[model samples]
Target: MAALSPLKLRVEGMDCGACALKIENAMKRLPGVSDINVSYGQESVALTFDEDRTSALTIKEKIRALGFTPISERKDLVAPRSAPVLSAREPWWRGKKGRLVIFAAAMFGAAFAAAQIEPQWSQWAYSAAAVISIVPFARRAFAGAISGTPFSIETLMSIAAFGAVLIGAAEEAAVVILLFAVGELLETIAAGRARAGIEALIDLVPRVAFRERDGVVERISVDDLALGDIVIVRPGDRVPSDGKILEGFSELDEAPVTGESVPIAKQAGDKVFAGSINTNGELRVEISHVAADNTIARIIHLVEEAQGSKAPMARLIDRFSAWYTPAAMAAAALVIVVPPLVFDADWMTWVYRGLATLLISCPCALVISTPAAIASGLAAGARKGLLIRGGAALEMLGKVRTVAFDKTGTLTLGRPQVTDIVPIVGNEGDVLARAAAVERNTSHPLGIAIVEAATARALDIPASFGGAIAVPGKAVTTRLKDGFASVGSPRYAAEQTAPDESVSRKIVALEEEGKTVVVLLSGKRVEGLLALRDEPREDAAVGIARLNAAGISTVMLTGDNRRTADATAGKLGLVARAELLPEAKLLEIADMKKLGPIAMIGDGINDAPALAAASVGVAMGGGADVALETADAALLRNRVTGVADLIELSQATLGNIWQNIGLALGLKAVFLGTTLFGVTTLWMAILADTGATVLVTANALRLLRLGLSVRHSTERNQ
Candidate 1:
């Protein structure tokens, strides 16, 4: 036995969710296949199977035999590929809209001619139109039946059309096929529009790069560029790969990657990403990452994985549909057999009625309603810089009534600066220099701030320190010349040796102003007090206010002292909980869950545990990789307002889904009632089913418009 690997294939000719279900069932029966997921919204199928037992070519051949085209081959299921290809040999009449129009026109022309001709000629005209218009549907239905799925929508439509023809309603049969064709065309267009955002993102990266070597530039594919290779990006061209600018300068528009909506000035030493356009000036960049490893590629891969994971509702619908079709077919059989056998009704009329019931009960619209709306919502959120992990996150975000934030990097800028320093015994420079030496290699923002303050004063920092150790969220200790020294929070220093009255007063004053106070100690004796402050983001208040207006409570959680937390919280008009360690923050999140569903927003490694514990976790895009990977959603622009926007988007998306479901089921109920009675004909039932599909699709598209409006408003405010 061999390990199972995943594969994805872009499928063509899928009009409704029923088609997706049919493909899924057919593929699931194959040996060694597992974890099958098919998304009608994305027109792609994903599955994991043992390569030794099956291969990609075999899977594609199976799909072809099932009456659909598998357009792209997947060597391994990883990143999403480009759109499906249409062979040049494919006839123009095979195009969706063109086929729909041609068949519809033929059906109408034949029906009109039949009504004006002699009775003997009328039969030939109607019969010819029926044969021509129904050929495509008949072929698909035949394929599905032979492939062991006798209850597919195509099969139901074919049965209905053939029944109409037998009952002397050949023109009605032609009209039903024409209308169904038009409906499928509309669905294809809607799905394409929903996928436009992802396609646009994929198109942003250029296929080729201008590599500079030996004082000359040569054009080569992006895949050929290796690390440390120099690439030249002229003005108005997209940066070919992710790298740092080695020479020249430019204003790069990073809106495509970061969703920042601004052009940032970049010079030497500044990092640039692939897919960003150079607005002005030429730039020579040293490639840091190859094409497949770039930021754009990672984003695309994450998005595709997110889209493939099904929501709870979507999975439930799949289960329901699995049985709905077979049961409906059984009911159709009962209508055909019982009414004629039990009531002595005319067999032809009852058979015609049964066929209409079969067509109306295909569950095409019901099966598609949820996924179409969810795909549109996810795409809309991605366009606005919010990367919602999957449908489950989107659905959960809508129910969040309380949002908790990690103060240091989420509510405030992660960068801290030294505000004041008070030396208790040693000279200011001597105290600062010793602290910087001990803190030089630390990743804590406060430690970095101390080192930066000493450097700004031109004090010499030691090249190395011996016996350095960090106590999480407390202090960093190292061996000094005469004795051990430490730089850390006041509580940690107090635990070693209580600070003097004067030093304690200084700490109180600094903390009162929302500054974080740390003590520099030498051998259990206080040397100086260092005050650092990480300012709140400019959009923090606006973001909190927006969440408040939407009736969600906000809380700031931090490891800083109580006074500093209160000061910051008062300024932002939110509640505060301070002096919390990583484990403490996790407990706080657990406690908050009693109030309602809680969402934690943070951008540091310490926030990872709590982020994973919360109902939903949102990470700032620029945060640590651990936090981002642990979070359920990410804000690419690193804006706090994106949190509020995500909430609104989720609410709107869930609402849109319900509306689609209602429209699909409500119309289905009406047509089913009319179908059972003598009031509905085969053509009318087909028209109703088609009309419902179009309405549901159109409703889902409204999310795209809503997304645009939200984006415009965000930009205007910015």
Candidate 2:
């Protein structure tokens, strides 16, 4: 069997979620296709299929046969393309909104002229106007009917308008088609605005880059640039690729990529990402990644994937709509036959009411409600440096009743700093110098802290320590000039050589203040103690407070001692679980799940099992690659406050979705009731359907504004 590869196609002419479902169902009938996901808001379809068994061209032809345009390469899924323009250029009268306006105007003019002519000629004029206005509707309805969706909104409108014309209500039929066309135009415009954020992000990367090679600068397409090539970026220009600054100094505006509101200073040796603007710099950067592998490209790809994944509510709505349209058709048939056959009612009036009921029952607005709000929420979160993996994650985040956090790189900076040093058997500088010599080769944060402290004091490090051996997460042991020297946690040091009473007292006092105390021992005697602390992030308190205020519980899980964990938790007013191994943390997460949905926030490596077990896994950006890849969401700025922002945005988005659904259903119910009472006409029914669609669309668009305001408030609070 050939390996299955993923493909994404930019689809055109999808007006609602039902269209997405139709395309998905049509594509699933093809050979070798799997995991098909189509998004009406993003207007794209993504799927996996065996390349040897089928081809992208075959898939595009199928979509075309289904009455939609597929306008991108299947290979483009390797690096998903930017969202396509809404439509192709056409004559002014053929443009989407413009054509609708022209058709509507023609219908009105024909109606006015018919009112002044003879009755026979008037009927002909009105009939001609209705036919012209209904052509587009009829075409769509015919396509949908053939594609196995015979009860689409277009089909309902076509039936209502044709029914009106048969009853000699040609003027009313013309007006119904005209009003429905206007509603479609408004919906298209609103959807375009909802998609603006993702489009803006895609546009941030410049197409051209200035490459510096052999002491010459040449402009080239960003796609042509290779890794290890140096790119010259000047002031007021967007960085073309992710790279390290080889020379020069300046500040960069990273708001586009990381959501950092302030400009970040960059000099030689500092890393820069693609899509960030060089504010005032003359820098030559060595490209670390090509155009397709850059940070911005990854962000765009993740966001698009997120938009394609449907929420639970969206999936339920999809299932409901499958049955909804067919059931509605049955009810309409009953309305027309039952009343007249059973009660001697007028056939014409009863049939007209049934046609109007069909128009009212179209599920366009309700079908679009959830995905529109979800796409907007995903886009908004991405702009603020929160990459929610899918609509399912977004909805889960809102319901998370408890959030468990890893300590080292999550709530704290993960960079430990030496705060206090005590020499029990030697001078402070001598003890630190000896400890640094043994620790300089270790990569642990505590070891690095000791080495940094010694270097800052200008203490000369010993040139050699004999045959060093490291114990993971515990201590480093080496042979000194006279005997063995061990530098590590107090427990590990005590196991090597018992600490004296004074040294034990000092270590206890430091650990009480939430500091990590490392003991230095030489020849079975305590040399000194170094108290290091990984300071809590500036936003940790605020983020915790915000979660607490929202009635979500917060817990700190760590490998540190109970005293240290308590001290840190007390500062943030959170529950603390200490001295946990990696597996222990996973078990604790399982226990926490009994309370409610759990969200585990970590840097992604050691917390992988726990993250996988939780309701949602949130990874900090710039952490381990495995962690970011495994997480359901990632905070690019590595800020704890992003957790709070994620919850707030999710709640707001879900709220917007419910509002749209209610509005769609409420309007349908009102109009359905009116039609049953004989108070509704063909034009009135179409107007009500169109009006409900517009109202729901406008409500979903409000999330775009809500997302912006939430981001601004987060920045302000920071």
Candidate 3:
């Protein structure tokens, strides 16, 4: 037995989700193909096949048999996501579609001229024109019928055209065929525009970079870059990968990757992302992430993944159309026989009306409406740095009525400052230096606050900090060169040596003000106390207010003390659940079920449980791997206002989807009424079917403009 080989094939000519589904079904019935994922949004098919049973050549042939062209070579099959190797595109004037349009239009024009020349020869001339145009297409319709889609749009179109000619409406039949051909060309162009909005992301990053290797600068492929390698980004060039600035300074425009149009000044120690244009000055950046893991690649992968999960509305529509097309075919058949057999109406008139009804029955407009809106929504959100994982999450986001936020890293700045230092047995500097020595090597927020304060004051602290040992959830103890030193909570200090009444009073005073106070101990005696507090973000209050205006309740969940949590939440006008452990936070998330659908927004790593427990999990852009990997959605701009923007985008997307659906059905209903009353003709029938399809797809494309409008709003408020 041979192992299964995975292949990604770039497929051309897929105009909508229905086209992808037809191809997917065909591949599934093939003996060797399995785990097939055909994505219309990605314009590609990913599937695994048993090598012994089927080869890639067979897969390509299968795709071709379904009418979608598989790109010609290996590079098209499995190229890098960020590679500049898009499948070669032929000009519209030279492609298969172009020739079809030319032939149909030329034949129609020739037939019309022939009718002008001789009135007696008009019927036969137009008949020949209709047959020539519709016959070639009818063959494909026949193939589709054999493949289980008996009532496909093509089949319906062919039937309508043939029925028109049989009913002695050859003039209308040729014109209808011409209209159909032109209408399909327009649909393809509009669909291509929608797809280009996403595929354009691949063009943001350069394929090569100027790598600095041991004092010699070399221009190399970005794929060759390894972690820790230094690359020099000149003014106007994109940073080749996600990295930290190692040398030089510059203002970088990160709008392409982050949607934050403001250019940020970056120097040594500041981070830079792939595809950000360095506006001014040269920067030497130390690569932090490989090419595959950079920002642009991840965004593309996420959007493609999102495309596979169809929206609920789309699924419902798919079910509706599955039966709707067959029912329409049945109605068309009955329309022809019912009046003629029972009422004894004219056979030609009744048959012509039945042909018009067949044209209206196609359901192509209804089938494509949902995915067009969805794909545009996904592309727009990605452009604005709001990454909704799939259609379900996008829909769910609009329904969220309550948003829960993690305190330390989410609502607050996540950077605490040492507010005050009090001495009990030594000067303030002496106490602070000892505290900083113990905390210099620690990663805790409060501990780093003290160390930062010491460094700001230029304290000559001891090296190695006496090999400090951390007591989880308590303190850090070290055997300093002078004597034993420690900095910890009052509870940990009390266990070592009890503080006097005066010192205890001061500790309680700071705690009452929502400041976190830690005790400094030297040789089992109280040295002094240090106070630290993290402030709420600048946009926290405004973001929460926007949600509240939208009728969404906001709350803060934190592991901090009650006073500290309350102080931060008060600024944002939200309630706070304080002093909760990780498990306690999970319990709180479950208890909030009564308020309706809720979204938990957090730093991604620490609040994974609470996020998972809620209706939707949102991770901040600055969050660690857990947030990006596990959250239902991520706000990649890392601003609190981005939360509001995401919700706004969600509502807009849902609204657009409904409008597209309505347009599809409403137009068909109007034409159905007209055809029955003899108020519509073959021209109107063609317009009703093809017109609705073009209209719905064109309407869905409007969502792509929301990216810029929403982005400008987010930037203005920030």
Candidate 4:
């Protein structure tokens, strides 16, 4: 550390690229400066030099000589507390748009100089000018490497650039630094693309709200809205905050949150959130919470939290970079000083040899290797309407070999509908009319199904039916002309008294047929039978087959009977079936993970915990609250193959990442190996190193095009 040389300067009015370049060139012309990188971005200049030969004051004066003012030191741009906030950097030029003219003039000058000389000097000057112009921009790399505990890509690059200058291969040094600056600029653009999804979430919240006060309505900032305020939400207007309806009813289009194709009906006492739009009717909402406490705000907060959380593979990259940079630096130093001193090698040959070593060790490969693949894979999944919260979720999804599905809403249509009806002791029309009359006043799924069936038959239902009462988990009873009538579960119907043996057997047969049979009974006599069942989703069988083809097994979990569950699973090629409650589902996932990692797809409110407990939790977008809130990846289109596509994308992304790493390391190793053996020139090494980086980046980008071939391959399957 004591032997390390430093050259720091109060870099002057580098208000433009030309000013920065002019200072860099003047400093480089000095006799003993081994390396020079100046950053007007941070307003600092760095140079490694002979301690006795140069001073900070001399560098400062030379910067002023370039016709700019020199400052004492870099000042803090904002308060210390504000430093932790992730500020968006200036879009194109780091907020230096005013310097466009100077930068353009410098570029033209460098080009003109390149055209006027012989090939060798022209190349040398062109590279030097580029390097000099970018010095101020590149100095952050050098400074960060020095201050940080763990070495990064910037450290390797800094070492490489200095190694070239130390051995007096100024042309190679200039080219290496120039190439690095260009790479940094490119990498910035790629990162911005990766972060677009996160930035989009931040833009969704409303800036203002209209609140009602006294007898007049007032416009107020969204943040100022407090709990209990009455907010007037008009048709097509976003709900100002989380609140409950007080005076009106409408249909809210909650597509962004729930992904339901149809608008949801909202009436008095129904809840709505800050970003939901009232599509049809006006609603007076009594705000229940502040704007910051609303659903939209929580969503934004979760996204930011997830983005900051590290993916599993991120640590591996840090470990690799830590060792990779210092090792390259040590090797570069040996290549520069050892050959000429020990073997009496020609100075010029050794200098070129060292520069080749430095060029081959550039850290571009290591920097772009993992993140490029992750970014591309995430973008691909997003395009397919799958919302994977982070890279960690994607990694887990890739390894899932077993997927457990909740049968009620995931495998079948969640709501029950009438499929069949039979009458053994009464008129069929009379039985249906009696069942509808009993069910019309109830709100249960079975009741809804019966009422809907009665409507389909055009049965006349009176608006007001007297003596109607619902029995919890059983049947609903109503007064009939002769006696009370009850339509409910077979057990409840039979409990009043035993039915005829023939009628009981008929009910058993219907249960075996996968229908929930409810008998309409008057006192002890059986009147008729009503069959209800959840129909399977239209695409369930096709989706299951695709999963099987992709080598994944499917399991069905449900609260329904073994007979009904098995009947549904059989049609979809599912072998593992569990007729269990929500807690049992969680235990099943835990047990399955012991065999291998398992993924769960569920839609019920009870299924949320089990979904979260799985290796990868996938929520059908139209699912219940717990499922939507707990799942890691959500299929926004509610398509099962989307879950499969996410898995494929994760696998492809992981493959691309490993491939890029191998490509980068293999190419760097070959070039470095040849340079040490004295077989490679600095120019060839530079070309190979930078060229391999570009190739790896391009290969990782293929993940962005990832898709399921199932749509096209259906022709062959047919």
Candidate 5:
């Protein structure tokens, strides 16, 4: 709710820079924008805009339209897509350009040995090593500095290294170069972790699907699968493409899209999406769309765009980092130039103090803070089967208070089944037989439930029943020798005469119990009730309770009537329930935000818009591409309990991040005070700086072992 400033832009080339500049400028230029800053040197731009005036994508396109491709690299920075790929390795020197680290290390070691052995040989050996290291691995630094981009992290480090060498401090020069190499390596690794989940999302969709041709299923790629093309999908296969089932029945494991664990039953005419796995039964489907427009491809596009979409807070970091590095440089200059000139401090001593300031002022904490928390939080969520796309999403998840949920795939397991059957006049067996016969020709959730229920009961379906009418969003009607029969909800069977009031009351009672009631009407009388319901997830209630305990209010939002939604909410002990359509749900979320942040959970086509509009949109892996792409977080395990774990993990990871920052800053402050007071020597400063790096690095490694002992114990108890 805080007002922010638009970032100001001062960049060039930028056909790339100009593009990035325009984005930053637009952000600043917008109404309610407080300030803006644009820098091509760091390959990012920052903006402070009113959350009300412009959307996240509007800013992204402004950058993209400038013809500078925008990369999804917001630790909260908006950078060109061509900006260096963020590091994907661990939080060590491992992922930095390996050659650079090796070269810098070799030079540092040679210079250090020379300094220890002979003072006269020290200058030459150290300067030579500095030249060698700079020529090989620091060209970018020197070139970037000379190219009018004077404030790059690389340029700063290179300048400091040359300054040390110029003073005949071979040991100091060598160490500075080495330290810079390590910092670059660490930065690269952090960047890599930010990009890992998004890259995996891109890889999920294949380039092709086997297109069927004239009775022969040939392996033609997705591009060739035109509308109306027949595609064959066998058990254990991904749906060839997004299409409607023309023949065959199967159970599909659509975990990748819906994030549900159970397989959904599919029959002829059922719509199936690409990337869904057919767990059982073979399916012959007709492609409804080309590969480019398939559900899987759409998911890829959404994720890519979402990755490019910066979180509201990411821009703040970019702007802060831009000013942060230069501010530190200015502070270091004060340490050197001010003390020696005004305070009459010795040149070597004050200069050493300046070097000490430089050593710790790499903005290492700033660089590592966001990504370290993100990687750790993401890893923890993934361990519990949550696939968060990147840091922005991960951070947003922790802020959500109200949680809007999709009905079918998110809460009800997406596969409804008949749980009870009652007959008022005839035998129950006869009522079920007639119902199943009518429903056998349809593939709606209710129809499938009836058929499956009848099959479970071993009821024999009548073969001669004919004239079945499959009505969308209504009861299926068919003719029997006895009379006209209908099976559907009370509301859906409106064409039939009203049912007995007593029977209707009972049906209402059944509905209140969270059972989907199917009224069996014979002419004008209600003959029976077929109660169906989506099976509750095994751990849903437990998960909801856990979330409540963690201070996150749980909510169930559905398109179903208030009775059904309220019943489910009561059963699960959810804090809130909103029986709403897609757009209504979005409005509900908007209202919820008046109290606090909201996280929306969903995995259906109808859920996409709400997911996009929420503070943190969470996609169930078993959901559609629209939902997944629009969501800020993904529950890979498709379990409600995992969401609780994700929140807990994010909170813990953020705690760790603050601790690391405090440690880094505290040590630097103490070291700076000691160096200025003459209580610390140059060697001490060097040790302190390197030691702080090592400590932070060690602390970051804790993320690698995701099985934190405290978390493990908590899970065991749970």
Candidate 6:
């Protein structure tokens, strides 16, 4: 069997969906090219080929011959994570599209002015303008015909422009050409906007960094910073790389990377992500990730790759455009020949009508409608910390009727916290310090949570004298300088000294409120009992309420005990299924598919299978690599309500695509009727098509506004 290989290439000149369709149709004719997806929004083409019959080089050459430039061909779909080359140094107005528009507009103006001065000189002047303006498209039309697409949009355009000129309708021909130049310029500008939005993300990282070595500070490129190198970030500076703070106390604003607007207080030993702004205090930081692999870099790479996959509607339009031009050309031939030969119409009049029909059937506006909106939607979502994998995923997100979340990390803040500290024999500080000291060296979740709580309170924790002895699922005991200290479950403490009624009631009440209770002991005497639980996030209830308002049902799946799951779910107003293994969660996701499309949000390695099983797998920002890779979308910020934001954005984008389609098809239908009835002229036909192109492009640009307007918090209010 021949191995099928996939290749992706960056297509620089492919600005419109019609161009992508032409390239796709031409490449598919090759022997071993089984499939191809050329995305105009992302400006890239992904194709699968049989290596036994064809090579990647042959494919590249074929694309080059189709009148487009293909660069940076790669076997891997993920492009380099460095800054994207979105624009050239020269200004856009001085580029090829600009120069062509300037020349054509000048000629048109001269022709219009000549008509008033000398009516006889007007036709020649208009003919010259039309001839010069159409030369480039005519050449490309020839190339397209030689390749596989004989009736491409460019070919239709050339025939319409040249036919009008030969028939002595020179004034309309010149107008048609000028309109085309303007339309092409509009498409070029839109292309820049699509790419520029992504470039904005890359601009967040400052180019220079201040590295301090042995107390001497030197400025260097951010890329030069490596692992373990200490860098100094002053107030008002953006953190250059992901690292831990060695010496600093200040409030850091992490709005850029995590989308949290409120600044978080930070001290030494706290971790910081690249692109987050430092609001106050000078900090000494040790670099973690190399420049190319920072969190921001990973996000940009994901967005670029996501743009390569087109939505179902966009794909449908691409295929429709391939055959639509040829069909329209055939219809045009029938209109011209059947009228004069069968109905005895004038030959000259029929010829002019046929030329106008060609312009109406170009399909340029129809083809570009879906992709332009999709590209804008993806860019907008990325800016707000919602990262959908591709257009298909974006479309799917809108249709999801049920959202299943993993409880531990998805609903609640995955870490346990000390909620209540009761003192039976001494003060709260004395009980907490001795408990933290006994657990400082233990590697358990509860032990770590206790130690963190003590550290957070700035309490002194003495080091353990020696190794601690742990009883499985019961208690851990260590010898202090005075005697033995123990921290464990209530039953473990009772073996030493049974709890009285007062202590028993406190433990029971805390347990009823969905907390884990542990007893603190000094020797055989009970000192106090602490209550802990994984607290629900502040936005969990509000996010679920939004989903409920949108008619989406919410549920939680977790491996934690039933009591703990119910406690968290009750507060969030969601249904709960507890103590599920990985396989069980996968089975539950399959069962939920009967309701409708499901979106599974998870954050651990065990959630990979379940994430993949759902209609769309969504990962939390702090998810494991396996879970992140398996998921189709991600909330890059730790906002529970980003799920609602993703759904809303998807619906808005889809609605935009439908509107663009209606305008394109509606204009063609109306103009086709008017031209056949002799109610419109060649210039009017071209003008209407140009008008549709402008409307579709302008409508797609609105998605960028929706993206920019995306809320930082999931609660809808900001």
lDDT of 3 by residue, 141-208 (tens): 87566666677777888888888888889989999988888877777678778878666888888989
lDDT tens digits, residue span 568-633, model 5: 878888844543545677788888889987888877345667877887777773544443444567
Q: Show model 6 residue runs off by greater than 4 Å.
A: 1-12, 25-39, 44-79, 106-118, 418-511, 516-531, 621-630, 708-718
Pull out the clashing pairs in model 1.
none
lDDT of 2 by residue, 157-270 (tens): 888888888988888887787778777766766766776777788788998999998989999999899999999999999999889999999999999998778899999999
* Winner by TM-score: 1
Ordered by lDDT, highest first, the candidates read 3, 2, 6, 1, 4, 5
Give the TM-score (vs. native) of candidate 4.
0.65
* Whole-model lDDT values for every prediction: 0.81, 0.82, 0.82, 0.65, 0.63, 0.82
Q: In model 2, where do residues sit more than 4 Å from their true spots?
A: 1-7, 31-35, 47-58, 79-115, 132-136, 423-443, 454-487, 493-498, 521-527, 621-630, 708-718
Query: Each candidate: RMSD to true structure?
Result: 3.0, 3.3, 3.3, 11.8, 9.6, 5.8
Clashes of 4: 3
Order by TM-score, highest first: 1, 3, 2, 6, 5, 4
lDDT by residue (101-142, candidate 6, tens digit) is 888889899888988899889889889878887887787787
lDDT, residue 596, model 1: 88
lDDT of 4 by residue, 191-230 (tens): 4454454454444446678899996889888889889999
TM-score quality measure for candidate 3: 0.91
Output the worst ten-in-a-row residue range by lDDT, candidate 6. Answer: 621-630
How does candidate 2 score on lDDT? Answer: 0.82
By summed lDDT, the worst window of 10 consecutive residues in model 4 runs over 77-86
Query: On a 0 to 100 scale, what is the lDDT of residue 177 in model 4?
Result: 51
The residue-level lDDT of candidate 1 at 9 comes to 77
Q: Who is ahead in TM-score, 3 or 6? A: 3
